[model samples]
Target: MPSAASSEAPSEASTAPWDVHRLPRADGKTFLVTGGNAGIGYFVAEQLAGTGATVVLGSRDADKADAAATSIRSRVPDARVRHIRLDLADLASLKASAEALRSDRLDAVVHNAGVKFDQPDRRETGDGHEAMFGINHLGHFALTHWLAPLLAAAPEGRVVTTGSFAATSERLDLDDLESTRDYRPDRTYGRSKLAQMLFGFELDRRLRTGGSTVRSVVTHPGGALDSLTPPRPPLHAPTTGERLRGLPAGILVQGKEAAAWPAVRAVLDPSVTGGQLWAPRIFGLRGPPGSGPSAVIWRTRRSRPACGRRAAT
Candidate 1:
């Protein structure tokens, strides 16, 4: 968290209406973005790299990660970035992955990696947990646990969790967190994101209780379309027809590049605080980043312990 005095200085400027184009410099910081090889994650990494910070792209695929890093270097000629292999679905690999991070003090970590399925069939991670819940929620939970020391070492370390608008309409079935009983693709995916959001809020509460400076924040990209996104070579290159088709959607939604704003602001903005939710400014769907709704109705206090227990098990 940036100090009140520092955030208020004219030079530091407040993020009342954060401008994605003019971000504050973070030359000495080292930030890691999970699943940063493509989609919204790649844009987040790209935008952050422009700030002169050393950005690490955490991806399960080495080839894609390398491509993303290379692409970033091409765009921001002086960008300092690298890639690390990280498979969120494999719980056993996270410890080694965290240890592999060379930075002694991690300024922030954007938990952006996730898996979404469209089929009705249920899928499980290598650890036998529901794929969505396991990778999106539990995996981040474990990763944060392992990286606690490094985060605490930073002046004001932060944890930014990428949630989804789908979570707003869903509820977590604590008993069937793995969705073994009733497995609907969209609903299951939504519940998993909701779980991740709750975990972020609860983690902040516990961190404050423990007198730790590391802050946890949650953000959601309301509606992002690939067609609306600009090309980035091997990662994403929408056809001209696709771009034309997405023109109408631009009024209600936005591109994956714009979707990355909320998370980028959460990581760079000094005014942002822990336990807060950030999202697109327009109807919580499109536009610049801003403070969004709180998840109080979800009763994170009561449900978070259950989520923690399940993850531990």
Candidate 2:
């Protein structure tokens, strides 16, 4: 396991307030962040841990989870954090995580784990679905479905799903949720992101329609600079000896930590609104959190413009 993640000791040069701590009420809250083992998920878990929140870092590897928890705890001496093993690629694991979490009412959940699309290859999941859509959308959908009861137990509990301006695609094929038909990395990703966004908005509508009020919000990492969308697979089929070509303008814009922020804030910040989006500034490079409309418009099955939050810095 990676040694307990080292705490990011605040630099004296940082613009954040010094000696002013803002910890959430952890007394009754139990939160979970999928893919909390590394990248932005780790730091988001870390910052939440700093507040002594009962944060659970959901990961596929138990060792990684332990390492992440240890590392996060090191940063916040009083952190009350732990781990839970979950693999988005497997439906059973998703069910297990949900079942385990059901034992403890989930005060909040962050559906932040995702995979970037690579050049076309036979990427399949246990349930026979394409890798990108399967892991990114279906698995998350199942997990959310499993945990809905737990979230609802908390009345005002929140569900924050990581979305992207990349979702601003112009079209979607509800008929082809698996991308069995025509596939392009950009449009595929955009479709998934669009699905997540619409899902977020639709979830809210469903809840309201059902007369149950749990806030379901979505966020966009405006540019690729911050969210740290993983790079594409090698262009070649075998991916051998090939340098793999580059990406479009905004594809690889943001850092993973920056991408994780919107989800983090969505869960921790009391101000987060259902169906609303948040992100960093720097044209998606990376920055502190701020609020605004998302650059991407949520379409039933397609999208329009891009949108997101700005940096407080």
Best candidate, lDDT:
1
- Per-residue CA lDDT of model 2 for 1-313, tens digit only, reads 0112122221223223222135454555778888887766776676667665688888888887887777766667878787777888898777788876645478788887888867766478887888777888877888998888888888578888887767655446655676776677777777777777677777877887898768887765444332134422121122222212322434435444455665666777765667555566444334555555455544433222235433221
Backbone clash count for every predicted candidate, in the order shown: 0, 20
Candidate 1 per-residue C-alpha lDDT over 258-295 given as tens digits, one digit per residue, 9 for 90 to 100? 99998999999988889877877676678888774453
| True-structure lDDT of candidate 1 | 0.85
TM-score of 1: 0.90
Q: What lDDT does the true structure give each of the candidates?
A: 0.85, 0.65
Off by over 4 Å in 2: 1-25, 222-255, 281-285, 300-313
The ten-residue window of minimal lDDT in model 2 covers 1-10
Clash pairs, candidate 1, are none
User: TM-scores for all candidates?
Assistant: 0.90, 0.75
Worst 10 residues of 1 by lDDT: 1-10
